[model samples]
Target: MAKITYIEHNGTEHVVEVANGMTVMEGARDNSIPGIEADCGGACACSTCHVYVHPDWVDRLPGKDSMEEDMLDFAYEPDTQRSRLTCQLKVTDALDGLVVQLPEKQI
Candidate 1:
């Protein structure tokens, strides 16, 4: 399992242990972490799972694919560098202490 932290726009923090192979969005939903809507259920078809990966770990994550980049165009307050869809981030030992910041809204 990997321990991941989800910080809301209001500064609320939720730390949870996610099983390896599960998506970050699944971790949030399973643990009831607020701010991750995941409307498309990790299908990469929606942007409701948008988040800002802490700069410290950004370089450690895999680069986004073209589909995710296109979907991000619909994210709220999107940040090309930090913004990412939680559904695209798979939990792994390498990301044990990953921290992601939630946006104010997900429409």
Candidate 2:
């Protein structure tokens, strides 16, 4: 398992143990991390699972696809380089210490 940290807007942190194959959103949702709502359950249909990848980890995740990019346009707080739909970030051993900063709100 790898450790994934979910940081709240107020700077509070929640760390979760993520299995190799699960996505970052899954790790948060399963562990009851408060920031990621994951309203579409990883389906890429909802932008409620929006998160900001730590600046250092931005290059670590895969580039967004058309569908995910389109959905992000509807995200509550969107950013071109930092914001991401966590549901698409699959966990990996290389991401053992992945940290994500949450936006203030997710509509």
Per-model TM values vs. the true structure: 0.98, 0.96
lDDT of 2 at 102: 90
Candidate 1, number of clashes: 0
Instruction: State model 2's lDDT.
Output: 0.91
Pairs of residues clashing in candidate 1: none
Off by over 4 Å in 1: none
What lDDT does candidate 2 reach at residue 87?
Answer: 92
Q: Write the per-residue lDDT of candidate 1 for residues 13-68, one digit (tens) a residue.
A: 99999999999999999999988999988999999999999999889999999999
TM-score: model 1 vs. ground truth: 0.98
